[model samples]
Target: MARVYSIVSGKGGTGKTSSAINLAAALNSLGEDVIVVDANISTPNVGIHLGAPIVPVTLNHVLTNRAEVTEAIYKHESGLKILPSSLSTQDLGRIKHENLVQVVKQLKRLSKYIILDSAAGLGKETEASILASDEVIIVTQPEMPAVTDALKAVKLCEQLGKPVKGFILTRHRWKKSEMQVENILDMLEIPAVGLIPEDKNMQKALMLKSPIVNSYPKSKASKAYFETARRLLGIKEEKGFFERIFGS
Candidate 1:
């Protein structure tokens, strides 16, 4: 079975989907068969980040027994396959627990890495996504609320006996920024894996519906994501100038 890694966050708009897309792209660049599963069925947008439109089939169709999971995946020329969500009529929708488990089992046999782009907040679906994964990347910003909420998610992961591989500090600006990162990690007792700087290129990439790694490979944000991917696969240790500034 393939190792699944879920990219999750506690609050909305903390760059969880961005991290998920870029990390999956980076893994593909390394010649790994990466499948990005847009598990955020309610508000799916990974396809937009990848510059791909919503495919005909999605997780919703598969979960509803309308299509096979394998048939719903869209293969990219970049070597990344994306399983986007059905953006049609998700009003008051919920993924059944049994179907979620079966979906994970089905994905395990199809790819080298199943990167689940989970939704914001601590919902039932978020909990199930984390529980199904062997490792998780909790993306957060430098703000207090983001850290506090992430701790709550960490506690949930602990309750489910899931291992949090590390935390990724997103939207960080200066090298000396995010002074609270170390405190957050110390309080949660989780390792710090990445610190992605705030870059305008990221926004431009999003607006253009292209991944930073693919659109601007030499950009700082892209390089940071590549390093994060390296750390995720144990190919390299965490190294960043901000670590010295934040003492993390």
Candidate 2:
């Protein structure tokens, strides 16, 4: 059975969607079958990020019973599968959020990893995504506001009886002004799963509408994402200098 991981964040602009896409790509690179689902119905971006912003069939159709779940799935150029939600505002209300769990169950039967890129904040859509997943990977920046929101998300997941896999710290600069990894863990009480460095290549990849791992495999952010994937898969590997210093 495939494991479903809802990649969520407390607030917007936390690189949650980016982390979800890259992590799916990294797993696919390892010869694992992966599917990325845009559960962020209000602001779906998985298709946009993969250069297939508009498709005939989408998650909205599946949820509304207009199309089968399999029909909504499209294979990306990078060999990963994506089930993107409709970008149209009209389709938003058509979706029944309560069906998310069943939709995820169907998806899990089709791939090794089913990554649901959830919407930001603690809204109804986000809660449904959380309940539909096996576990959650909270994404946040290493700052006071982001960390505070991450803690709220973690607590929400706990109350819902959803296991939190860990936290992914994105756009990490390791600057003196930023909150240290230790402090973040101490505050959130969740182990650090990964740390994505701020890289211009990530922006370029976004412009190109491809995952950083595929567009610039040698970039720092790509390496971090790959490392995060490997760690999540429980694959043992040697730690690099940055990991030794920052402790991923």
Candidate 3:
């Protein structure tokens, strides 16, 4: 069965876009057909993160009725398909946020997994993404500020009647100041689907305009992402060395 997942965050800089890209790549590598859509129409990042900063056809065009949803999808070199939004500021005013669900529906017929990278904050695009998804995964850091916003995101999901699967803790360093995984799960009342470490290779992957899973497959962060993918697919596996250390 096809499932559409929206990767949302309470605020920016929580690694939401990176999560969407890498998660999609991970699933594709595991023999699933996946498409990562940049539903963050306001401040799009998936295209930039994937190194295709600009494309002729974009989600903006699909939203504005200037193009079909099928026209906007571009397959990454790694065989992962992506539907990126236009980076132009001019398209913002003309966007039809209400049409996103329709585009997502169109995407569903084309792939098994549709990963929607939503805009940060509870904005119009964010709500549209949530409505378009079958399930949502919130991404946040290990700090209070990020976790607080993540909690807010959880409440917003409840208010909207959207089912939130779990939260992905990103850039976790296990520092004394950072919130622990158990406490975060307690506060948010959700499962920990992913616990990404603070690895420098993620930045290097960004610089290379490739997913960490593809650019640095042997890196700690890459392994975590692949593990997260397996968890999402409900594949049972033993604790990885990182999972043992992180204690998730």
TM-score of each: 0.91, 0.97, 0.96
What are the runs in model 2 whose C-alpha is more than 4 Å off?
Answer: 241-248
Per-residue alpha-carbon lDDT of model 3 for 117-186, expressed as tens digits? Answer: 9998988889999999999999999988899999999998999999999988899897988898878978
Lowest lDDT sum, 10 consecutive residues, model 2, at 239-248
Off by over 4 Å in 3: 240-248
- In candidate 1, which residue ranges exceed 4 Å CA deviation? 90-94, 175-178, 237-248
lDDT of 1 at 123: 91
State the local distance difference test value for candidate 2.
Answer: 0.91
lDDT per model, in order?
0.82, 0.91, 0.91
What TM value does model 3 have?
0.96
For candidate 1, the lDDT comes to 0.82
Worst 10 residues of 3 by lDDT: 239-248
Tens digit per residue, CA lDDT, model 2, 9-123: 8789899889999999999998899999999999898998899999999999988989889999999899989999998999776679989899989988899899999998899
